[model samples]
Target chain A: MSDMRDMFVETASRLFRDYCTPDLLRAAAAGSFQTQLWDAMVEAGLTKAAVAEDAGGSGAELADALALLVPAGANAVPAPLAETLIAGFLLGEAGVVVPDAPLTIAIPRPGETLRAVRKGDGWLITGAVARVPYARFASGGVTVIAETAEGPLLAQVALADCKIAEAANLAHEPRDDVAFNEAPAQAAKLTTRQAADVYAMAAAARSAQMAGALQTVLQLSVQYALERSQFGKPLGKFQAIQHNLATLAGQAAAATAAADAAIAHAEHGAGSIAIASAKARAGEAASIACNIAHQVHGAIGFTAEHALHFSTQRLWSWRDEFGNDAFWELKLGDQAVAAGADGLWAMLTAAA
Target chain B: MEALSFAPPPVSEEAERVRAEVRAFLKTELANRPPFKKADSWNGADPAFSRKMGAKGWIAMTWPKQYGGHERSALERYVVLEEMLAAGAPVAAHWIADRQSGPLILKAGTEEQKQSILPRIAAGDCYFCIGMSEPDTGSDLASVRTKAVKADGGWVVNGTKVWTTGAHIAHYMILLCRTAEPTANRHEGLTQMLVDLKATDGVQINPIYDLAGQHHFNEVVFRDAFIPDSAVLGKPGDGWKQVTSELALERSGPERFLSSFTLLVELVRALGPDPSPAAKIAIGRLVAHIYTLRRLSRSVAGMLQRGDDPAIQAALVKDLGALVEQEIPEIARQLIAAEPDTKSTSDFVAVLAHTVLNAPSFSLRGGTREILRGMIARGLGLR
Candidate 1:
């Protein structure tokens, strides 16, 4: 890691640690936008970190931006910091002025379509994207790459112009259902990228977040095991609990490695295999880590009030987001199959 | 949480350049070998092949120049190792010596020992087997009953070492035995001694065939085998520390995860291009795991290169790598229906047979899963 990246991580972790309190998380869970948390993030210039300076934002590299996602996930921050960074990158890539407020990117699910048609100077975008992350709170508007008759077009549509049927993920983070009906939007031709690229980036983002959450889960489980006792000894004294925590530590390590690989590859120019394999491995780690964590924590972890759920719920929900483990695994498997027996080793090594 | 940190491995141009050369060599060397034979991988001992590797200056790659080493970086050595394992190249003839024993001797050997053995090992003419595990001791290594008593100008050793891989073929054995009586600390009073298997008197090696019916393991009985004073590896009563200091290198490597790689490669060939989604998911998940394991393993290699001991992280990799390696055979059977048959002419079936039989040893070797997890738990401050 570069000194710049280490410094950024230190700053971001401190900001998150100080602001993302349980009270703020609870308030956001109870139908409140993390206005204060998001404001602090913006005030720190983090919201513009992934955008280029010429694009009216901070000039931090894409990797520096992605590195911040780990701390965000670690604290279970009740805001779309990852989404905003990704949206800023995509919009900046399209030569659009990056937004300065909370932003979200629109990735259409299966059988869903978001289409854009030229309307005078701007384009009109119509159709719905299911479970668009934080769409209800995207004050900077949602960045969507909708299909057009010519090909695919990039558009930025305001939340007020679109109908947002509010929804939430497993952690009660906003994943609203947004529908657009000939909404006035600013659309441009994406000469350098496509919608699939956005999906991969988002998946990588989720992977980074999962890595962070897994770390927290491992820490929480170990701390709990040491504090809680059964049969006159700390739970950690038992071989069973120790082994479970050991497994959790392995998962956390794997997830962090996977996420770091994905971020590095993405920064070097995204290799589809690296991103795909990362999301797949990190998601797999999340599942195993969550199970072991909850098992070690026992009933206290199952309850809503326990601090463990903050990280665990985020892990459960983030693993499903930006395409699940099975989804990325199938894609990677298809690549391997296409590479065939002779080419599989070459493919994997070449990506490395 | 503090014990676990696998930073991304740094890329090395020199390592990448070495990778191409290694691949080209493996391509020609393994072109005619059948997949069934290739499945043997590092377990397939071929001294002639090992000598070829030595002639290429590929053995003892990271030692000092005077010790017949190339003085290359650990990253370069890693690239060579992974390439060999991935291609299922026969490396067992010099694997243990190159990976651990050679480094151990270099680190703690006497100048005489280094001059006599280091060059031979670098030339791949000398092989070494670890004489640590005894009949009564395995994971509880400090409790070893193999005893060595002081004799004239040397030590007289008497004990049996079981599961000593390559003991029959290895020219030397690094024997870990009790040099003094046990005290409150079981880890103390143990010492490492170098025994010349061929030259030593009253030392016998009996073959122990694995389930795969291969003579990869041996039971060596030393009945007062005289090891001269010059054969002592390090200071007396420091065997426990010396042996354990190498665990990170032993536990973290591509070999841990790439053990059954031939099966996966053959499975892809059998599945063809248009297999079921289930097949893709299984293959893809396995690929993801191998990729992640490689990252973690490489991170450890980098740590080793930087002179940091990553024993806990290494344990985590081995434990996880073993899980994935063991899973391949079980998962392969479900993706395609075929009884594992070593006699079958089909590459997939034969590789499957070999892999299934050998899968159990992946976790058992180096350290058992339970033992590694215990180590990790201790690293986590649980013990």
Candidate 2:
């Protein structure tokens, strides 16, 4: 958390709070996208914060860029801020042209690898990538990591060139499934640990976002408890409500701490252990945090109009998105078990 | 938004160096200890092991060297504590003295008290226990009625202390007693008196066995036990401040969460390399929590090192840690088909059984969950 990073957070956070109005959220959730908000973000140079300066980005530190996701998620900003920044940075890292619009990625999961056939000047991508976020309205394209005859190749393919069956996560953000039938793509330079790197970056981003959302619900729960009265006192005055909010606060705190660790480690290229713990911890914390938050908020929070739904729903969706707790936990558990009893502590304390 | 701050300090190279040294030392020290034996963790006392730690200058590490401390950074001490707990080294021998009592004595004790007590504590020969809990007063510590009446050149103590861990074997006890009539504030008249267990008269230690049938806990009765005027560790009516100041240190250690760490290791070993996805998921969730708790707890240590009060942060760690540690045995039971058995000859089952029997105390020990939650609520400005 440097002073320069603070500027990015302060500036972008103010912009988000001003532009990401409830009306804008409602419109975005109702299938009408908020272009003006995205414009504000782009004008503020947040979307390209992670891209290299030579590649026409704001050249903000990767950590500074990642930190913005907290406020973005906190405000429930219905935009592709984290994804675009990460994708743009990935493209630059692979020595490819950084896109100027909203971006998403097609990363292969544990046992799956998307393929690309080297065809002429560009590569022909062939894969059925599920849940490519923001692809439906992504003006730029989706970054795809395709396995080729020679190692792995990175490519950015236009959504118009592929079949996108539009869908939405619980938060109403587009999470469309894309099927590439020999889709022509810009053959970006290959990157090391291709899919894993992207997934790690995305998981770290999601962890930050999840941290933000957890903070939102926690505040909502506490504020609600303080305002809503019963038994001749405010809900916050009740022992039960106070305890529940305390639990929510713990969840929120753990998620925030976990997110900070994840970003810190991810920034240092600490790999799966750091990234996995961040996502797994944040997702796990969110499970308890969201439940406790909604429980504390009671019926008023259950309504679609309530802002609590915005954060909680996003948390539920985000946890399952870029690899859930179970998905990442298995990876960590595998490494730990393989290391055996003696090596477990070493693995755990290795990053520190 | 105003949650107690735990901005993790920059990763200390010194701490990492200490971590490596501790790991290497533990490797040789615990090479022969079985996992089930390790499951006893910090509760299992071994004077030899504690002496080895003391020789390494690991005990009373953050105190001044003149007081037999190494003057190491708190993070370095934290790294050592984390490694010890993870490896299940027998740290109970001097855990209390190292964690709180020695620090309290250094902060508030007379120079004579520090000269006579600290070096022995640092050498890991002397042990200490908190004489705070009584028969009726537990979480409501302000209501403690242990009396210390004025006597010739001293005070006479008459009361009983309950649930004092390691009391039967501890060399000394930092006795919290009522020194004066209660004022408008119940917490005002209490004082901390140093009690020499071996030298004291009419002091009886009766064992209070745990569910595991262990003698780690005790009931100490004092009937007109003389505490020389010099034995008062701090000023009269200052026990509340001293005890309150020590609360964060008592609650924020790796012991709070790592009590059942051996159980987690045993669970992982049982699951092996290629278990069902479900087992892996359970293990992963546990690992993630352990990692996060370490970060939070370490952050508290940094705060403590920087001379900041992190009572709220410490409470948060202790509360969340108790939930996670207690969740181990229950989750481990479901992840595997074996019933937790202390004598089944299977280390995993035995460790699970030990943990099952012990997990209930994790929340009960430092501060009960209800009390911790109340503290956290106050931290959240809800109370």
Name the weakest run of 10 consecutive residues (lDDT summed) in model 2 chain B. B1-10
- Which whole-number lDDT from 0 to 100 does residue B124 have in model 2? 87
lDDT of 1 by residue, A49-84 (tens): 888889877777787788888888899988888888
Candidate 2 residue-wise lDDT, A1-352, digit = tens = 8776789989988998898777788889998778888888888888888888898888877877899998999999898888888888778776777766788887877776688887777788898888788888777888888888787788888878889998999989988888898989865666565677777888999999999888888887888888888888988989988888888888888888888888776654425687788899888888898888888878888998888888888999999988888888987888788878668878888855
Q: How well is each residue in B120-219 modelled by candidate 1, as lDDT tens digits? A: 9999899989998989998888999989999999999999999999998899999999999999999999999999999999899999999889998999
Worst window of 10 by summed lDDT in candidate 2 chain A:
A263-272
* Model 2: lDDT to the true structure: 0.86
Highest TM-score, which number? Answer: 1
Candidate 2 regions exceeding 4 Å error are: A110-113, A267-271
Error of 2 at A14 (Å): 2.1
**Worst ten-residue run, lDDT, model 1 chain A?**
A263-272
- Itemize residue pairs with steric clashes in candidate 2: none
lDDT of residue A93 for candidate 1? 71
Q: In order, what lDDT does every prediction score?
A: 0.88, 0.86
Residue B36 of model 2, lDDT score: 81
